[model samples]
Structures are given as structure tokens and as C-alpha cells.
Target: MKSKTKRLFLLLLSVIFVFNFNSIKGTAGKSVTKTVRVGYYQNEVFQEGASDKAVKSGYAYEYYRKLSEYTGWNYEYIYGDFVTVYNMLLNGDVDLVAGLAYTESRSHLISYPDKPQGTEQYSIVKHQGDDTITTNPTTLKGKSIGVLDSAIKVALENFLKEKNIAANVVTFSDYDALLEAFDKREVDTLAGESDGIYDRSHAETLYPFGETDYFICTSKDRPDLLKELNEAQSQLFLEYPDYISVLRNKYYPESLASRAFTSSEKEWLTSHESVAVGYLNNYLPYSDTTKDGKVTGLIKELVPYLFKQLGYETVAIEYVGFDTYDELVKAMDDEEIELAFPVGGGLFFSEEDGMFISKPVISTLTDLIYSTNYYDNSKQIFAVNESNKLQYYYIANHFPDATIEYYPSIDACLKAVLKGEATYTTLNGLRTASMLKKPDYEKLSFRQLGYADDMCFGVKIGNEGLLKLIDRGLSRAGTEYVNNLGSVYSDDMYKYTFKDVLRENFIGAFIVFLIILAILILLLLYSVRINRKRIREKEDAKREIEAVNQEKFVFLNKMNNYMREPINNIVSLIRISENMNDLTNIKNNLAKMGSFSKELTTILNNILNISSFESGQVKIDDSLSLYNFFGKRVLIVEDTLPNQTITSDIMKKAGMEVQIANDGLDAYEKVKAAPSGYFDAVLINVDDRNIQGYLFIKKIRDMENDIRSEVPVIAITADESESGKEKIIKSGMNGFITKPYDVKAILDKLSGIIL
Candidate 1:
């Protein structure tokens, strides 16, 4: 009995020891409640109000509360305006203050943490749909910029001075006042911190600058408190690597509200109580109506939501359905409907058609539906629906040679192809996806046309105010919701049964069987005619080979003659120019020599191009056009006189002042003597026997003047392979143009490098 009592006592002592150990481990590296006086200010979204309210809410508030888990510090909040609170921190009234932008002057009296709490960046924001202001800093000239009287204002002034932009800086007491001035159109733009502007979905960031770290600052005398704060911050980061991002996301999630309307738009909205919206009744999954007259589809569902977001009552929208696009458009034109639904396009409605369009809600691919029997038609014929003008126009413009058969609808168009009246039809792959699954279209297949059909709303012309409101609402609806709504309406994939396939392809299969049987019967008689046919074929083959060889011989002969004439003319011109005493005539002859040299180069390049084609080694694109380099100057370095003349003439034709340097030393000396930016670009011949191209470019790159060293240099070479191109780039040349380059090729290369 005594031994059992001792065991029970030991068990109780062990439980008590375990509890104490856990308590110690839980409080490891944490202090008891140390009341730290924190200076707080209303820095919207970051911190707000005084005492308990400031400590309970905001990004900084959350950060401090999270930090307290480690530091075990309870904040004694001292509330005041921004300046008063900051001065309190300096005067030692408060131990620390959050949201102080770090500066050299602030660092003298206060100590900031080694790592910043967060970065505060400022931007110039303008109202959404304001087209007068732009991202260009110069656009701010003579404009009034509203700024909260804080560090953001100072940053704006610095930005103006640095960019040499002269603008009126209108200061307000707080962010609310600044935003009010902007909403009243008293200022063209407002400068605000990122956190302050994050929730204002109506404001567009015109220019972002003045990025600086905001720190939790403390007095220099309180090193011990600062150390504890810094250590706690480090511990918090170590525990949660994404703590800062989490706090920011929690506080500043993107707002779904649409931008407020302008005064004119508001007035227009007040006048119009309801809007008549029309849709194509047959365009499925995008726009359609039930037999009961209830409009239902992916985009139809989105329209009411858009109105709701735009602050318009959904009941005010009256939906009307039309069987055809033409009918819908007519209704819109006749004032029967104020807007049309689900107009598919890269452009929904053209201004030329007297209609305005809103932003697209969803986009789908365009595809060609063709018969499986004849993949390639001998005579191309496209079936287009009268309702789908986009498809008809695309077919007409892209395949002008193909014949088109008009139908009433996409269904009729596809049926015409099945009946063999038309070879194919183009359509939106998404809207007709359900029809494509049916047995009627099982024999048809889709080929992507590499075009997108962005479904959008359309309205009549002179209704831009309404259109603007629609666009604003659409923007607020967000892409995710629009895409998810589309997914919800997407039909499941239809699996075809064996019976369905057989029933659909019965007639075509039977016709194919007949053709196969006829071919088999014809095979029996083929042997009898084979011997005679082979004899004739042998003779024809011999004649064809002889004709091909003759053609080749003639082509080579013509090319040889063409090459000789240009060279002979160039030699004669050079000799004649040397003998001429008249300066004008000499210059004219030199120009003729340049032209002849260019012709000779073209012939040689053609020969190389032909060889490349036969070997399938290269294909030169000739679509590039010569870029204008008017008022620019260029230096041409070449040992060959003909090449120098050709390149110089090319540059001169491009309206550039050209200077010729025959040798590397002369070229180097001219560049060294010329002022910075004097020569726009330099063309160096890589095949120069005297000066190595790589070494010459290296010399230019190593010039004493920085601007001169970085002048655009283009290498001229015979090699066009990838390895050769890489080697040229590695040799310090900006870019390289191949030998025998035409005006387009040379100038395109020059413009890319120079510009």
C-alpha cells in the first residue's frame, strides 16, 4: 500500500514538470508586456484613427500585432497629424512610428531597421477614360497636379524638376481632398502613394516613380527597444516568409466597383431610364433566346451584371432578340434597340457603319468547317450565312477566287456543304460547338482559321456616352468572372455512337465503295495496256529530260550574259571617268559606275540565291522596305572602290551625308576627329584584306569618348549563317548586313541599330 502511494506521488510530480517545460518553451525568445509608445497618424489603408482603432485596423496595425507575438510588446498609441506625430517621435514622446519614408536627414535623429517594413512608391493618376493626360512626362506640362501635402508632394516636385516638366502642383490637406479636387476636374492628375491609390479603381496610373522604403522608426536613445523591435521583425519574417505580401493582399484587394461617371454621362443616364438591348437569336452560347422570350446565354447573363456593376439597375435593361444580325442592326438604327448583343469581331462595330462598340467580354477562335470526303477541293466554294457578315467578308477578301453561296444562317451554310453545293464554311468555333457534336455535322470537321472573334456589345453612333458607361462596367466585371461564366455555359463533349456514324456516312461510304469496285475491275485490263503505255512513257520521259536540260542551259546562258554586261559597263565607266576633266561630268560618271556596280552585285546575289534555293539552305525575305534616314550622316569603310561607291550611293539615296574611308587607319582617324554623335552610323566591310573587321570594331568600341565608342556599327559580310551572325555580334558590331545587300536590307539593318 505504501509503495503504490509513492508511485502516484511521482506520477503527479512528472505531470507538473511537463506543464512547466511547455510553458517555458512557449515563451522562449519572447518578453513580457513592454508598453511601447507608438506615434500613429491617418495614412489611409496603412493606419487610421487614434489609440485602440489605429491599433486594431490597417496594414501597419496588423504588422505590429503580428510582431507582438514575438516581442510581447503592447502599443501605447499617441495620435496626431502626420507632422505632429513625426515630431513626437523625434522629441522622444513616442518610442517608434510606422510609415516614415527613409531619408538621410531622418536617419540622423532616428534609427531605422536594417530591412524596411515596406516600399512606398508614388504615381501620377488620372481618371479612367481621360484621354487628355498620357504616360509621357511632357504631357504634364501646363497641367495642374493635385497632391496630398506629404512626402508624395515633395516627390512630385522632384520628379518635375528632374524631367524638366513645368506643371502646377496643387497641394491639399489630405488624400481625400486631393481626390476630391481630381474628381471635380480642378486638377488634371493627382499624385498619391501606391497604397492610397490601390483601392481607387477609377484612377489610372499615368507615371510611377519615387520608389522609397518606408521604415518603422525609433529614437536614437532607445537602442535597446529598437533592437527588440528589429529582432522581432526578423523572427516574424523567418516564421512567415510571405507575411508582408499576406498583409498587403488582405488590406488592398482590387475593388470590383466601376469608375464614377463624368457629369455629362451622369446627365445622360438620368435622362434614359431604360435601355433596349438586342441580340442575335441564333448565335448560341454567346447570345440566344428561349421560346418563352427569356434571353439566356453566356454574354446575355453578363450584360445585366455589367449594368449592376456600373451602378445602373438591372431591371432598367430591356432585352430584345432578333433572328438575324441584320434585323438586330436595323432595330438598333431605328431606335427600337439602344444596344446590340454579342457582335463577334476583332472589331465589334466599325464607326464607318455608324455604330460604337464596347470592350469584348469573351473571345473565341474562328475555324473552317469542311467536308471530310474531299479535304482539298478542285474548285473552291465557300458557303456563308447572310447573318454572319464577318465570315462572308473574310471569305471574300481572303479567297477572292473562290465562289461563295449565300445562306440564311450558319445552320443552312453547313447544310449546303453537306449537300455538296458548297465546299466549306467559316464560323466561330465556340458558338457552334454544340451543333458540331450533332449527327448532322459529324461528317464535317473544323480547321483553325487563326483568327479571334471577340464577342462584344454594339450601339448606334452618337451614343458614345452610353458606350463609355458600358465599357466602364465591362472593365469592372473583370476577366476571370467573364471567363468563368463562359465555362459554366460550356456544353459537355458529345460522344458519337456507332449507329450515328454509320447513318451519317452511309451515302458517302456507298459511293466510295462503288468507286473502289470500278477501280478493281479496271486493274484487270491495266496489264494489257501497260506494255504500250510504258513504251510511250519512256519516249516522253527522254524528251522531258532533254527539255529540262535545255531550259537550264538557256537560263545559265542568260545569267552569264547579264553578269558580263554590268561588269564591262562598270570598267568602261571607271576608265572614262578618269579621263574626264569636267568635274560635273566626272561626278555623273562616278554615279553611273555606282549604279552599274549595284546591278552587278544584284546578279551575283541572284546566283547565290538560286543555289541556296536548290540546296534548301536559305530563303531571303524581300518584304522589308528601306527606312528613311533623312538628315543623318554615315561613314563607309571599304578597300574596294566599287563597294565604296555602292554603299555611299545607297546611303546618299537614303538622304544621308556619306564619307568614304578607304583604309582602317583613315576611318579610325576620321572617327577620332569627329565630334560625338557627328556620325550616325558606320558600315565596315568584313572582307577587307588589310583591316580585320573584328579588330577594327574593337578599336572603335575602345575609343576614349563614351558616345563615340558606342556609335552604331554594322558589319558587311558574305556569311549569313547563325554561327556567322553570332560571331559578328560577339565582335562588338551592333548588327551585320550580308554582302550584296539591297537598299532595303542595308537600311533596315541600319535603322534597327541606330534607332
Candidate 2:
């Protein structure tokens, strides 16, 4: 009886122990779940609606939701107007407030992240054809400008004061009211964000100024959260450098669809019974596959329609759905699908893998999307797509300090960022833009990073024929299709119709038309005046030519005297040689005759050089180290005793080490045999009988040693005409010295070229 009782007691204790263990495990699971409190305002870019009970919608909201999934944190959103939300954050009722622009006043109350969620620039928007209205602050003086009663309005007032412009600023309670005032002509200009006011065909966006960084605000008590948030935000930006641009395009959809298919592509499409197209299973705006297996999205609706228009009456589009972009790429690579729509640039596809890509079906910007609290953080964890080399390289180059965490998909990376597990993620601008417009992702905010590469379709390497066909179809779609598609996806689909254009700009257009007509008449009168002036100038130029010709003739006569004396001397010497009986006497006479002949040749060569120089046939290779060369050594080549003495003296006086060569042949031999760079500059007299100056220069230029060939050469000549200068330059000589050398001028030219 005693043993039975002990067994029952022991069993009871064991059962109690098991129950406590199970209870503790359940409690611990609940404790692990964290609740994050978010303060939201009803702003279109931040929070879309005023619903307090429903899921918060906006860029910030959606971003945090994804973050919650990443971090295993639950978000409790508190909704209010801008002021209410801001106060809640300061009061610690909310952990953080979304989409707050950083200001000195705000900074004193709450701590901000290191990097902004995005940037906002103020734009002066005016109706199309309002040419009189300009972006200049001075021009805006005395004009009525409409602005919303937000931080931007304060910025505008400050700007006006700083610029000293006296403008009548009209304040509106909301962006819609501001735009309404602009539309009704109540205000001449509307100042707002570009994404809010930019229109391709209707409103002209101008004068972007007062760029303010938007951030998430957190109480001083939650510095840790702010620090974490900042790290994550910075990492996101590093990965997706153009996330902000994507946001702008998403809200605006400014890119037009203009690709048209070629005839061959259309023919190929018609021949094929069906085409297999891969699309994302859940990528919104770009592509989406439903539970019923129906594919629909911007790419889905437009791609099929584009095919139908390309002569394929019943071209069947067999849709293949993939959970991630990677899967889509794999499907294309495996030839399971001929093409994949709404894919990234060639960076995502490898050429080695044999992929043929089409032109972008939709083009948009890329952006950095992050929480506002972590605006300036750098040492943060970044979530990036593992396969995206573009993002990988960009991040590696720009954000070296940030830790990188790879995800299979962009969405997954973004989720990591949202959860605070990773600091930030980058994405295509249009994709971010589309996400912002949706209620699910309304809380996320982005800053324009840069223009993203256009999104295109990808095909397997072997599908070149089909790829061309798809590209051809894209080419046929044209700009209208793109504009229409943008309108469908954009926040405002209203385009400027002919009637609207006329109604808005009739007076402006009429004034412009009258001004243009007047300008044309003025231009015509100016042309007539210019033509009359040109005729008179031409007549005057002809008279000037006659005077110049007379002067040249006189100059030539003076030069002829130099030739005549040399020729006469040579003839006298030859006649003397004929009378000589002894061999020594005969040789002496021949030598004298040769000297005279050489003198004549030198005069003739000088004249020829002058003519060539004047004709603009000479090109000077001015690239020479004159100071280093001339300071060391200079070679003076001249057969004439008087000229040689003058040349050597001038070179010595200029601080150049002189090496005298009696004639051109001697100079050439010295230059050819000397070590490279031995001579700094060579002074040649082309009149030498053995080798002409031109031949010497040409030989030096063609030498095996580059240093010797490149040495500066200056011609010493009696010809003072422009033609003489031309000839020296044409012969590859750097410059010319007249019969009477000017020491200062020669030194100056040398100094100028060398130094």
C-alpha cells in the first residue's frame, strides 16, 4: 500500500513539471514578438488617407510593414494630421513619426537619422505657353505665386527674402488647393514638388529650389531605434542608388512607350502559333499573376496588345508565372519561356549565358528607399539582391563601410531593410513609384537617386529571331501608347487636349505669334543691311590686294640683286679657272667658283622658303624643350664666315652653349653621329652647297634616335619677307632669324617654346 502511494506522488510531480515547461515555452514565444509604434500623417507621399483603424497606407507605412516582417515586429500605427502626428512622436505616444523634413526647430525636440528618407525640391509650375513667366527669383517679383501651407511654404518665404524678391505669395491649405488656384489663374505660378506638378504636355515645370531632406523623427529617449533606423536607411540607399527617381516615375509615370516592331518581327510573330512569356507572380504595376492564372499588369496588358497590333490577329500569349525575377531569368535561360517581361537591364543578365534583350518596354529612375529616421547613417547593414551585379558594384564602390546582406529578391531585401535587420535596399525608380501609389506600400518614402536603365524583356540566347520580333513590336507601339499607359498608371491621367491648350494659352500664344512675326521682319531687315555691308567690304578688300601686290614686287626686286651678284661672281671665278695652267691654281679657282654658286643657291632657297611660309604650307612642331636644350648646347651651321660669326655670338650671348658646323653636310654628320639629345637647337643656313637646309631638317626628322630628330631647328636667312618665315616653319625649322639677328627676339622665341 505504501509503495503504490509513493508511485502516484512521483507521477503527479512529473506531470506538474511537464505542464510548467510547456507554459513557459508559450510565454517565451509571446515575449519575443516586438510591437513598434508608428506615428503617421495624412500626406499623399507618406500616408494616403485619414483612416485611423485600417492598415496605414503610404510609402512609410508599407515600408514599416515589410520591416515588421523582417524584424518579427508588429506595427501599431497612430494616424492624425501632420501636427497631431508630430506631437504624438514628441510625447512618446509613438516611437517614430514618418516623413518629417529636418529643421533646426525640429532637431531641438527630436533626434533624426543620419540620412534622409528622400529629398524634396520645390518647383515653380506654370501653364504651358507662359513664356513670359520665368524661374528667376527676380522675374517672379510682383507675380502671385501659390504654395501649400507646409514646410515648403516657409522655405519659399525664406528664399524670397534671401533673394530680395518682392512677390505676392498666396498660401493654400493643401496641394490640391494650390494647384486649383494655379489652374484658375488665381495665381500665376504654383510652387510644389516636381512629382506633384510636372506635366509633359500641359504644365511647364521650372525653377526647382529649396531642396529639403525628409526624415523620420524619433523621441530623444529612443536614440537606439534612431541609430538602427539610420543605419538601415543608408544601406538601402547605397544598394539602390536611384530609389528616389523610381518614386517620382511611379507617382508620375513620365516615360513614354515609343518602341515599334520591325516588319520582319511582325512577320515572325504572325508565323508563330503562340509565344511563351514569363512574368512575375506578384510584382505589382509591372506584372502580376492571379490565382486563376490570368496574368495582368502594365507589361501584361500592353505586351499582348502590342503583339495583336503587329499583324498577328490571334497570337496566343502563353503566360508563365515565376515567384522571383531569378526564377523568370532561369525560365528564359532554360527555354521554358521564350521571353520574360519587365526585367532589369543587361547587368542582371550575363552575355556568357546567351541572352538577347529587347529595348526597355518601360523606362524610369532608380531610387534609395529608406525610413526617414535614418537619413544620414553610413555604418548600416544594407540589403541587396545577390544576383544584381550593378547594385553590388555600386554599393561596393560607394558604401565600403556598410555591411552587405544578400537576399534572393528585391522584395526580400527590402523586407530586411523594413524590419531593421538591414539598413536599406535599392530598387528601380518606376517600381518604387508604383509601390508608393498603392495603399499597401503608402508609408514607404524614397529619394530620387538617378535615372534607372529602362526595363526590358529578356530571351534565351538561341531566341534571336523571336527577340528581334519582340523588339520590332516594341518599336511599333510608339509614343502614344507610352503616354496613354503612363496616364493609366499615374496619379493624374489628365493630358492637355487641344481645347484645353487653346483655352489656357490663347492670349499668350497670340502675343507670342505677334512677337515672332515682328522678330522675323527685323531679321529680314538685318539680313539686307548685312548683305550691303558685305558687298562694300569685298570691294575694299580687292583694292587692298592691289596695294599688297605692288609692295611684294618691290621686295622681290631687292632680293633679285642678291642673286645677281652671286651669279656674276661665280661666272668670273669659272672664267679665271679656265685660264689657269697649273693643277693647284685650277683647283683654287674651282673652289672660289663653288663658293659663289653656293651663295646664289642659299639666296634662292631663302626666297623659296619665304614663298612657302606665306602660302600657309608650313606647320611648326612647337613642342620642344628649348630652355633645357638651348641652355646646354646649340649647333650653328653656316658656310659663310661673316654669318657664322654673328650666329655663334648671338647664341653665346643668349646663354646657349654653341657648337659650330661650317656647312649643312658637316652639321648633318655631327648631329647624326652625336649621342641623342647632344644638341639643344640647330641653326641652319639653307644656302650650303653640300646639303640644303630642307634636306638637313628632313634627315634629322627621319633619324632613328627620337631625341635627335625632335631637336629644335631655327633657320638663319637674309630673306625678311613673310614667305621666308613660312619656308623655315615648313622645312620643320621652329623659327627664323633675319640677316641681322635680334638677340632679345631669338631668346624670347626660345623661352616661349621651351618653357
Candidate 3:
């Protein structure tokens, strides 16, 4: 009896202990806060800054803050340069990193979530004044470019290589330095994120190369953390479908919401009760109406959301099932339908047809489809829809001998080709892809035959208001939405010819073989002409160096001669003045000295001006109008006594109302105190030490009054190089004049620019 009581007591103790342990474990799980460590670098719209204050306010920081709210996680921020932060994540020093773009190399080191956090486009940026650089990659040969030492550098290098362009690529440590180098003319072009460049008013995007998906990456070992982050992100997106757009607009407002509703447009929307929309019955992926009369597809989903956002609460969508697109147009003309979607091309509609078309919702490649075994040398029948005038014109012009057969629909055309009723059919690549999925169309193949067709929406004539509304809605519907819709239906249907296959797969090998053969031929040629070529090259280089040295020597000798005359005259005048006791004689000698000094200044100025013009540093502004601005009033800021007199005399002779300031400080005060338009232009000597030319100009540019701030300022400098001009222009100067002012040249420049 004692042993049984002892065993029962022990069993009860064990059961109670197990129950308490489980309860404690559950409580611990609930109380513990998971720490999420994030690594990031400074970017304009992404990380923003490395400082704790700025990092906390950045897009990535805000994103993580929202994520923490969803996941109940605490964040620890780690900041460094991009490469260093990337390394930290790789080494597991950080649990996750924000604003990382996925690459094949990066994929091996870290894991990205299934859905990207956002997208950014990469662009080639150039000075707004630059017009010589073409958008074509082939034109980039031998051009200099600035890029960050990150993924952008790799992308730029790859692009250059692919185009066979041997460009000079300069890499910077960060985006700020890269832009600085470009602004300073160290590099003619820059490659980076579009938002950074587009934000600058002085810079413009030449072309966009590609887009990258931004992700919050995790260390390879932290897959569970990555999964949790993704879940939190998905929840946020689900709860707020416009979260990404809102973030983008907050950071890059200039790139989004470019259009605003006018008062009239607002009034129209307020007065309207509902909008009538129409769609076809068989336009897959874009729009489709079911047999039961239910409408669906991308247009149906996008149009309603857009209308709602535009402040319309109700919409009436109708499906118009016609035997042919022509019949559908006839129905619209008769006012049976207000608007129709998935219209093929603009060529089908005209003012005469009483229809207005919106901009393209999507672009599709046109392809020619035929059976694999079918071939005929004689005149062949081309199957097409009569409503598709663009395709009809293309076929009739390209195949003059072929006969055309009109079909009611794309489906009928494809069937006609398959059943040998027509020799071939031309259809959109996207539609062909959707049709080829069926087993019956397995034998049909396609080849791209024409330019891309733009699919849009058509409205009845005189319905301009409805057209405008549709356009506004389409503009608000971002590129990602349209691209997603396009990707669902479009497929690669192009059948490569034998030549294309060879070029794509083995061109490198073929080029190598050709190079080897050429080398052998060159060797044979060299054996016969090597001696002559070597002697000629050496002699030519020797002659070239000699010519350059001789030219410099002649220029220096001429300059010395010019200076000697002025010095001799001044010395003679001084000696004469020393002997003269009469006041008139003394005044005469002083006048001669002044004349010599002026002549000497003119000689030096001419030399510098010639050099500047020859080096292409001084760009003449042909748009200046002397009668308008500069001819009326001008301010001259010069610290040097000699420069002040020379510039004032030149401007005065040019018929300008010249106002002189002894220094930058004096100029700033005078300009600030003056009324609007008191001075049409300003010419400041950048070499002045007091108040500093750049600082003074910046202050003037930041003035509260628009007219006073916008007064064109020209830089006067002795440094006649491109860098000098660039520095002046970047300091907010409208133009620059190299030292040694010519009255006629100065007047001409002012006249061209002042208007």
C-alpha cells in the first residue's frame, strides 16, 4: 500500500510539471520580439542617406517600419557604402538588406522575395544643352561615360560590348560623385537610376535602357526571416493595393500624376451619372464577354478601377458581339454603343468613319501564319479581316501578285488558312499564341512580317469628352499594369531562318575564324610592304611634333614683340614726364602712358580670346537681343581696377547702361537693393576674391523676386578652357566671356543673348 501511494504521487508531480513547462514555452514565444537587422546604402529614392536621422526617414526605412507593424519585429539599421553593405549581408552580419536589385551573381549570395518591393528604370543622362549624343548605342562609340561602381557599371559595360562600341567608361564611388563629374564635363554622359537624373532640372534623359526590380534581400541562412518578410509585405499589399504607387509618388512625384483635372473636367465628372463602356466577345487577355453575357479580362478590370479613381461611382459595360469588326464600327456609328475596347489599329478609324480613337492600350507584333507543309510559287490567297486596313495595305503592297480573301474574324481567318481555303493568314503574335495552345493548330507556324500594331479604344464621332476621359484614365494606369496585361497573352512566335540561327549561335566563332584568315593575309602583305610603312610612320610622327613646336615658338615670339612696343612707349613717356615742368606737357605724357597701357591690355586680351574660341570654350548665344535686355542696362562686378575699367569701357561703347561694382559683396548689395529689371544682365568677374563670384551668383539666383533672380549673369575669366566655362555655367551664369574684351565681340554676344 505504501509503494502504490509513492508511485501515484510521482505521476501526478510529473504531469503537473509537463503542463507548466508547455504553458511557459507558449508565453515566452508571445513575449519575445524578433530583431530584424537591415543593411542599406544612400540613394535618392531608396536609402536616401547613411546618417541615422536621414536613414530613419528614407523610403526603405519607412517600408521596414510598415513591415514591423505587420510582423511585430524590431529593426536594427546598418548603414555603409553599397559594396560594403552588400558584403555585410553576404557575411551574415545583417539579417536583411533593403534597396537591393537582383542579379545572377547576387542571387547566389542572398535570397529575394517572390514579389519585388518596387521597380526602377535605368537611363543615360546628359546635359540639357547636349544635342550631339544620339540615343542609338552605336553612336556611343568612343564616348566617355560616368557610372557608379555597382550593378549599373556592369550593365553599361555589357551594353557597350553588345553593341561593339568601344566607349571610355569612368566609374565613381557613389551617385553624387558621378553626377558631379558629369556636370563638370569630366564625362559627357552618365548612366544611373532615372529618378536621380530626372530630378535635376539641368539634366535630361537621353534614353532608358532597362528596368530593375528592387527587393529586400536576406542572408542565405535566414530563409525563415525572408519568408516572414515576404508574408508581411504581401499582407500590406493586399490591405493597400495602391501602396507601391503611393510610395513612388511620395519619392518621385514628378514622374507620376503628370496630368491634373481641369475645372471643366471636374464639373463634367460631377454632372455625369454613369459612363457607358463596350467590349468585344472574343478579345482574350484584353477583353472578353462570356456566353452568359458576363464581361472579363484586363480592360474590364482596369477601366472600372480607373473610372472609380476619376470620381465616377457607376459604369455600364455592354458587350457588342458582331460578325465582323466593320459591323461593330457600324453599330458605334449608329449610336448603338458609346465606346468599344480592343480595337486593333488607328488605321481602321478616321474622321470620315465618325470615330475617335484613344492612345494604344498595348502594342502587338504582326506575324504571318501558315501550315508547315504548305508552299506555293504561284499567286497565293492571303486571308485577312476587311476591317484591318493596316494589315490589308501591308499585304497588298508587299505581295502584289497575291489575292486577298476577306474573313469575319481572326478565328475564321486562322481556320481558313488551316483548311487550305486561304494560302496564309496574318494575325497578331499574341492572338496566334493564344490560338496555338489548342492541338488543332499544332502544324501552324508564324514569322514576324510587319511593324507592331497599336491596339486602342474607339468612341463615336463628336464624343470628344469621353475620349479625353479615357485618355486620362489610361495615363493614370501605370506602365506596370499595362505590361503585366501584355505579358499574359504575348509569346515568342518568331521562327528563325537558318541564317538567323547561325548568326545568333556561332557568330563569335565565325568572327574569330575570319580574324585568323585576315591575320595570315596581313602577314603576307606585310612581308612585301613592312619596310616602307615603318619608315613612313616614323617620319610622319617626327614631322608632326616639329610642326607643333614651331607653331608654339612663333606664337610666343609674336606675343613678345607685341608687349615690347607698349613697354617702350610707356618708358619713353615716363622719361619725358620727368623733364616736363609745364602742366600741359605733364598731362600729355600721362595721356600717352594711358594709351600704351590700354593697347597692351588689348593685345593680351586678344591672345586669350583667340585661344578660347579655338578651343571651343566660348559658345556664342545667337538668341540674345541687344534691343530687348542687355542693350538697356548691365551690371559689371570686378574687383581688379584694370578689369573693371576695361569691361566698363567695352560695355559703354556697346551702348549698354553700365553699372560697376568694386567687389562681389558690393555687387550683391547693389543687385539686391535694385528694383526689378533695373539691370537686364550682370557680368561678374569669377576671379574676384571678395564675396566670391560663385557665391554672389548663387545668392542672386535664389532671390525671392522672379525677375530679379532670373537676370542673366555672364562670367568674365582669364581661364580660357572648357573647365572654366563649365564652372561658370554650373554657378548659375547664363554665359561666359574669356578675358581681353573686344568691344565688337562683347556687343555681339550681348545682343544675341539679352533678349
On lDDT, the leading prediction is 1
Candidate 1: how large is its RMSD? 31.5
Total backbone clashes of model 1? 0
TM-score of each: 0.39, 0.32, 0.34
Score residue 416 of candidate 1 by CA lDDT: 87
Query: What lDDT score is found at residue 578 in candidate 2?
Result: 57
Q: Looking at candidate 1, what is the lDDT of residue 720? A: 86
List clashing residue pairs in candidate 1. none
Per-residue error (Å), model 1, residue 435? 1.1
For candidate 3, write residues 1-755 as lDDT tens digits: 99999999999999999999999988986756798787867776666767677624656768878888888888787878777888899999998887777899989889999878888887777675676876677767778989888777878887787778898999877666776788788898888887655345456567777678888899998988988888998889999999988887787665411233444555656666665566655556666666687666676677776676555647554455543466667778787877776664444445545778888777767788887666453647898876545456557656768889988767688778888888888866567676766656777888886677677778887777777777877766766787787666343223222221121223244345436534643543353254345446687576654553454345545656866787677667667766878876666566566566656655555545433432335543444333444348898987654455556645654567888887777888998899988888888888745638898888888887467888888887778888888888888888887756554467666766775
Which candidate, 2 or 3, has the higher lDDT? 3
Count of backbone collisions in candidate 2: 57
How well does candidate 3 score on lDDT at residue 101? 78
RMSD (Cα, Å) for all candidates, in order, is 31.5, 36.7, 34.7
Candidate 3 pairs with clashing backbones = 605-740, 623-752, 624-751, 624-752, 624-753, 625-755
- Please report how far candidate 2 places residue 619 from its true position, in Å: 99
